[model samples]
Target chain A: MSDPCIICVAITGSVPTKADNPAVPVTVEEQIESVHESFEAGATIAHCHVRDDEGRPTSDPERFARLKEGIEKHCPGMIIQFSTGGRSGAGKARGGMLPLRPDMASLSVGSNNFPTRVYENPPDLVDWLAAEMIRHDVKPEIEAFDLSHIFQAAAMVEDGRLKRPLHVQFVMGVKNAMPVDREVFDFYVRTLRRLMPDATWCGAGIGRHQRTLNEWSIAAGGHTRT
Target chain B: MSDPCIICVAITGSVPTKADNPAVPVTVEEQIESVHESFEAGATIAHCHVRDDEGRPTSDPERFARLKEGIEKHCPGMIIQFSTGGRSGAGKARGGMLPLRPDMASLSVGSNNFPTRVYENPPDLVDWLAAEMIRHDVKPEIEAFDLSHIFQAAAMVEDGRLKRPLHVQFVMGVKNAMPVDREVFDFYVRTLRRLMPDATWCGAGIGRHQRTLNEWSIAAGGHTRT
Candidate 1:
């Protein structure tokens, strides 16, 4: 029998706003409700990003705490994964919520270009975020934007910077970065399995490619994020 | 019959100095002499970087002109390719020498991590450099530090931002970046071939892995740099 697929629901990404999609939950209360609904729909993980009063993305630990509390209250047994992505904050601010000790957190192990700019994840910053995750005993879902990021994650695991039995996410369709291609997607899965045989991976796509990635991930025996 | 190998000689890189290696060319005259020697030793392309009076890397067009003149005079029929790499300069200064219009210039289409910092090549800057190269009639040697770069190059070509018949370099063994792995090197070659069948490619490795990359490139029917 095929392994059971883990479904992660990203209720509010840093880039999307209510203007982009009316149903995108911006407030903490709405986020909790959306995640609760997702959990009832069989989603086990909630990949989260918080917004400020004006609906702008921020790395405020207070906002993350409230959201975490709401999720725990409403959706028991659901995993909470905070985003340490560059879009919400700069430098150390991106990892400010690590001390909250969410069940999991997104970690970009290397830098790459986004649609409009270069996503600046310097080596020292990556090291610091990884160290903070270790201190807080939080699992990192390695965000593999490019192929080298997967290799970097493996290197970190080998050096004990990250624990074994890694969990990585293959992100695709970001302009100026990796686009959604079947061959490249297959190569990513093959490379990850070769490097970390016991590791688990998820596939995520930006904009219109989200459903395509979900289907591909399910067919490939990996996880998918909505 | 097999295609003839094109040997490019990078006489002086931005990071290496006389202190790092006593043999590294520092002055323009020393660089010209080094290129002359390499040209005589069957190197057809000269990958050049200029230094200021105190031996610091700079994007000064005047120094580049002098070096270009010296190479043309001393090494007849040699291809002079200037280094527009980030280590030598920042922002538009990195492409300041493109107006000189050497036979070719290096171009990085995406961003990735360097040893201790981010090698930033923002999308706008990449487009500007590509436009300048087209304006000056200079061919670009697309520097692929990671896998997405090759895809970026192909995208640029498809969008008419970059001309076809591209030449790319597969760089490896850089700390905090892509390391020298045989499987990855092969994948890079395969991906490039699948994306742009008419394009030419070369292999480059930093530090001790340079010779290994040379052998790999030559054995794989691609070019190499020393």
Candidate 2:
């Protein structure tokens, strides 16, 4: 038997131009199908980023509610992972879609080159995001890119903003960001493990990087999902 | 100004099949051109793993001599890095290549899963390799993957078998081995830093893992060449 674990299919992650992938699934009806298909394909988690009707990225509370309700109705036991990532003209990203109070939300510590602009998450933003996740009864999946991010995440856990057995994603393979080399990956894992000995973590790759570290995750006895 | 770093061109390493890439040079002539191209394109290091005359992987002394002569005549001052990774035949790697003792040699510590085989780098072999590198004025680069590898490398350095200002390669994203994710990469860096605070290390990727960590190396500000 395979591992009875949570496999989250991150849908509509990269904000695509219409010229990119047409099947990005922006509306509620389309998101419902996408979640249903992942459920049928044996995923226990549905990681989502909401977009407008015309396919523009949005952090509108109503759209998030519609997407959550649709997914919950279509697939009952699936975990709902809402993104705190806000696109252009969406204002500040921290706690942007937290009002809906999904089962889980994403939180990143430290600033990185997120496409054209930096995904700026100051220390205060992390504390606020963690507090909101606790308030909304949502589990915050800590996203980290470099060494300092791990340190920042630990600070949140220590300050009582996050609970123990933390879940983190060692994101890699982004251009002008951290390199996804084996020794670096080994170091990345060791540093976090040293800092928070018992934290649960996963590995992710930008673009096709998901192709490699996911396997490393499995080898290292960490949970790796598609 | 751009980074004034020495680039290492891996003309051919141990882990490649015909199905992987056809451009993997297998002969002295091909290796010479590969080195020449690398020098012309801003590389100052050539990490070599010699193949037999028939294009199959081999570690014969004659082939090593030919490769050295070719590099000396074609691209002088370009550093040569040889591998202790031997073949399955001839009973635990032929012992002649070590005598040539190039400018550098790779000493991969810890056991890891490579392809279908278990790469067992016993502690005894590590000590022997370290001693060999020290004897010949060849710098020993401790190659590692996963957390255990980091631990082993640190132990080797602590034992005084490996030299100071430790040189290492953060190899990431290889199948059946540790990954090249940001978390893994940074963790490795953190662990190494804690053990040997001033160590200089670089990174590498396998197959299609080209520039991911290379750019990360530049941004993170360490030894970015490997």
Candidate 3:
């Protein structure tokens, strides 16, 4: 009945800006300081996204490298997970930061709807991103926006594209994507365990339900993203 | 227990050609003939897609008009459902034929991964399509490729974007989309019932699983497409 909870902090997602919340970190130095504070406060993992000089999301490998260096210097042993999310970039550019070889990178294996547009993770792009992660020896945190994505990850694992003992995160409460529901969360955990017995999983709830998912995941003996 | 199954025949989908199967209909006359034959064979609904002169898929309104006229004249009382699927056109072009006021039109309320690319049904596009469907009084066969889509349709119904008593089709067995699974199929039915008690549903299996979904739908008191 005991499990160690791994708290992953997504300091700055692709969305949300200073206008939305002034505390949102947008620069590499600010991100490092914010991540160090999170690490000191008990977050073991830093889920990161890079922004350009103008504070727009970008997949610049150099920016990623600088962020990684800053985090490693300030918060030693803290897990750094770069975001390869679609909003930051498109096609191969999304994986451009993989060469920096962070501890982990967020990967979406299937496409689903976002708030206003389609989160386009086509098969070829998915395969390519996975291959890049493997080549760079960077672990992937599978983002399961829908039920099929869990199965897609399993299929990729079985097909030798992804390694076993998978790490998946079930995200909910997006506008056009899966909403926060207790039954769906329970089903997701059950299905993940049934499909990949050795796999580890987590839960992420967007907006106001974030803490709700954190509690649910921790109580269910899974990790959590904050 | 008193459910009467509505059999739908997709005479010519966006994919497949005379080259793949010489019997595959391409021209307007061929499509009408094929649909008429299907109507005679017990199909109540004709799911249609028009092809160009060289056999490529097109969203040409003139061709759709001709096809509609032929189906109406040849098989009275048969339901004509045009495919507003992504392959035939992009953006508003996909809904151009909705003004023809066919009995129904296939509508994808959410996006998912197709075989080679993202089947992008963006929110704006989905909203626009639904608006057009409402304007033309054409019933939408909500294409539920994944579980969340059912919830999306339910939300749309609640918000008045889509009418009540939804018509959803669970599509399975595409390469990157949802695969054919009995557990998933059952879950879809149960979830649909739980979400929208009065709503009706259908099932469609691509390629090899066509008959399997048909059997499942018929056995479960739902409609089916071939």
Q: Per-residue CA lDDT of candidate 2, range B141-160, in tens?
A: 77765544555566667778
Worst 10 residues of 3 chain B by lDDT: B1-10
lDDT of 1: 0.94
Worst 10 residues of 3 chain A by lDDT: A1-10
DockQ by candidate, in order: 0.92, 0.02, 0.85
For candidate 2, write residues A56-147 as lDDT tens digits. Answer: 77777788888999999999988998887635223345476787889888877555433334455544555677888888888888877654
lDDT of 2 at B165: 69
- The local lDDT score (0 to 100) that residue A21 gets in candidate 1 is 84
Model 2, stretches more than 4 Å misplaced? A1-4, A86-93, B1-226
Give the alpha carbon lDDT tens digit for every residue of A67-186 in model 1. Answer: 999999999999999999999999999999999999999999999999889999999999999999999999999999999999999999999999888899999999999999998999
Off by over 4 Å in 3: none
Model 3 Cα RMSD, 1 decimal: 1.1
* Deviation of model 1 at B139, angstroms: 0.3
What would the per-residue lDDT of candidate 1 be over residues B1-226, giving only the tens digit for each residue? 1657899998888888788899999999999999999999999999999999888999999999999999999998999999999988999999999999999999999999999999999999999999999999999999999999999999999999999899999999999899999999999999999999989999999989999999999999899898
Best by DockQ: 1
